[model samples]
Target chain A: VEFGGLRAHCPEAALHAARAAYLAGCQATSNVEAGSRFGIPVSGTMAHSWVMAHMDELTAFARYTAVHGARSILLIDTYDTVAAARLIVSAGLRPAAVRVDSGDLAGLSAAVRAVLDAGSLQETKILVSGDLDEHRVAALVASGAPIDGFGVGTAVTTSADAPSLSGVYKLVAVERESGMVPLAKLSPGKRTVPGEKQVWRVARSGETQRDVVATADELGPPGGVPLLRRLMRRGVPTESAPALDAIRDRCRTAVAALPDGVRRLTDAERFPVELSPDLDRLSRRVGGRDDQGP
Target chain B: VEFGGLRAHCPEAALHAARAAYLAGCQATSNVEAGSRFGIPVSGTMAHSWVMAHMDELTAFARYTAVHGARSILLIDTYDTVAAARLIVSAGLRPAAVRVDSGDLAGLSAAVRAVLDAGSLQETKILVSGDLDEHRVAALVASGAPIDGFGVGTAVTTSADAPSLSGVYKLVAVERESGMVPLAKLSPGKRTVPGEKQVWRVARSGETQRDVVATADELGPPGGVPLLRRLMRRGVPTESAPALDAIRDRCRTAVAALPDGVRRLTDAERFPVELSPDLDRLSRRVGGRDDQGP
Candidate 1:
């Protein structure tokens, strides 16, 4: 939800990041424009700079609580984590959460959780952040870190580990006077399939079994559901454009249906994308790779 | 000047990127917003997608020439680099430049240059792109590739290799009723120097010798030029905010003054950022490393 790092990039990038994160199921974003535009909740823990700006860590927490009340999530790792947690309890401030942004997150979260529980302030949550990604989140969860939530930043915003997706937008067909003509790039090591295309997915017992990339004109193989739909006509969006929530729900269902290998945090198996017979034939003909071309 | 990838990020991001690049000595930007905002020239080569969208590559080139005339930079590596170069010369379409977006940039550019020369179209420039960074650009230059210009994307926009800078904003001192009070963070593996600071550069002739970060209030050591100036006061920018062109010129001068190691494409020696004696003493005292703490 924190987009301060991205703000230095540009206002729109930060806003777009917030929108994408909201659409992808993040609970809230710290960017005000995103909150206003998307109707998502806005929340943020205080920064280390804020804590350092005050005379002491306790003073910063107390001042922030006074201003933001229980809604404030006090950042506890500017100087020390345990001392700050103790100070929060001693000051009788029952904030919504205590965030640990540095140090060993697993140990810190556990220690903070135990202190909050012992003080009968079990309602206060423990939120961990700092270089967290899906793999790190899973590791913390597996270790029973007593974390209530996470404040993901860099890793989420930039897709840091795998920063760029291997996505390509090749023109499948060209509009001609007669009809739509298939196009293909036959460069070695960079060949592209020709013709308008659609992907059909096969699911068995709620799990996706396979997918076929085929020509868009066909109804596709039996027992498979087409994954692409016409969403735009000219410059106008069609009725097929679903509401954000519906799209998010559908995305959740689709992701859940994927096999375990594709869902793993690391070394995920590549999902099969088989080309249909029609698509293969069109590709070969337009690419000048047929028997007659030689 | 190419900014298609950034335009896909966000309009503001694209604009800001263009502004930054222009201010960093780039001659022009492909972003129209930047051109309008900063009075910088805008230029671009056609995308492969545009060519693929048409019935054929030649048709696309002809249509683009009819619209853009000699200003057009025809992209030639969509299907085959050599074949497209031959077509360009044969078709009598004299574009300003021919760009290679894929393949061995060095070899392809040389081949394209030779073909253009043989056809007496020697005025055409050779532009190269695709996963290009400083090192790759340097390699092309070192190998004497016929490249006249480059269209750097991902690496520059994302700051990919060193994606994130280890930037921190520690409140060195807080404003109090009587005076400014210095503060410090004493966390293990992370320490902050106490007090307001300024960096002084000691340059000899046209080359930089060293830099010293010291407390702001003091007159820096002899012959050292203070690099930090008062830019703003109480949320209002001071007169110190110069025009972008002036800032750009200053940046160029400063960069030129840097040592050779700092300018090298790889394995550059880290620039020294030493603290002054008083600043060092203050850091030690406030960080509690002067004596062991329990």
Candidate 2:
């Protein structure tokens, strides 16, 4: 429903992020473009604007439900959440869900759940969304809020908490007349590791133990699987990309293989990323003794 | 040069924002699509990745300058800032400018300027960019940093400080059987004024004094100039949009007419947005006593 919230900012980025999220195990997206482009399932309710567009909230609900029918997930918090809940039942319109976009979501979800149960509308789910991130989602789950699912925006689209990832395409190695010469930025607090690299994931009994970033030429680490594969060659794709469902399934399996501590929503333990001996040696040679010096 | 720094995240949003900035007084944008779409001047240099791809920083600089000639703006902070400066002058490639992408911008710019002047490359401009915002630019100017212009990203494209603006497309009035009926959301902390509205600005001697948001039906306030004009009737545009240059000029004039306090880069005073008498009356009537009630 709220894909427009982020889409209004950047249609391209929002579509990309939605596709990524969908391919990373998200059940559905509200972005129609994401659905049309990637064949992902699209889901949404109505916006507060829809309710605000009507003379009265009840009329808005009736008109929307009349048109959208059982597919309607009426937005309830535009004026009064509880009042809207009572009104939805009183009008005898059965919507798929009632969404709470603002206010205390956890408490309100519980309260709304009670209202629906009291009205014997047990099948009607409650959906909540407001500045939702992983932490908030975990908190709501921990509190046992009766929210069936989430409608996340802003945070996911913007990558809010850590909006920009620190990625540097540094001079790892340069093609020289004599041979490949290692290169690195020795800038203080911003030194680069030298060489074309590959990540080696070490798993023990189906659980990831650690990852080693190594020079691509190095012999494969014992009991390690290479994570990076050649995706393209000379500006052409090496092979067709996997189906979105297959990728999502692979992601689910990989995530399930993580240790519980590393999977926690908040204060999760960091996974160890070690450098291979060859890469470390090259980095030291290129970076010199004082790594901080420019 | 650094368009990718911002473009990598939100291509759609960045392009839209770039076009908007171009139309609103910005001279040029680094986005190619923005330029192609809006016929705005496109500007850019090379990223660190381009330099890092070469055998050596100096060789990279020489090769780029050899091809691009005087139009090239050599990015100097990829490896060593000062060393790159000396190499640029020593290699006898007088680039149009030298850009600093990282490190202490204010101090580095001054130091780079000294190097350029000492090398007798006085005409070669100094461009600096790294996490720069309006406040940072103002501070750089205040500190007498010899910078030519800026390469602002992230902040402008993402509206980083306040990413999302709360805009509501509410039904001010609903068409009814008899006539149009005013409507408002009485939701706590989100109360809205009813009826179609128009903003009237009261200016004296070219500086804006105040703005009154009035019911559309209300007669124009004395000495007030209407700011909002009908741009479209039904779906079709009322008229072709004004030329980008004209809009840019108008934006510049409008910005210049702002009060100095409101124009400050930091700790700026808030501009008052007042409601018209009729609108205020309607709000009170719609709100009732204890407007916080559900």
- The Cα error of candidate 2 at residue A27, in Å, is 2.9
Residue A268, candidate 1: Cα error in Å is 1.5
Q: Let me know the DockQ for model 2.
A: 0.30
Q: Best lDDT goes to which candidate?
A: 1
Interface RMSD of 1: 5.2
Model 1, B144-217: lDDT tens per residue? Answer: 99899988766655555554445667777777765777777776666777888989998888799789999998
What's the CA error at residue A231 for candidate 1, in Å?
A: 2.7
lDDT of 2 by residue, A1-294 (tens): 335335345566677788878866777889887899989888998776678666578888999989988888988987789988999888888899999888889888888888888888999999888668778988899898899988877666665455454464565776766677666766656778877899999999999988999999897678999999999999999999899898889989998988889998768999989999998887887777342223
CA error at residue B233 for candidate 2, angstroms: 1.5
- The best candidate in terms of TM-score: 1
Error of 1 at B238 (Å): 3.4
Provide TM-scores for the models. Answer: 0.89, 0.87
**Model 1 chain B, TM?**
0.92
lDDT of candidate 2 at residue B268, scale 0 to 100: 90
What residue pairs clash in candidate 2, if any at all?
none
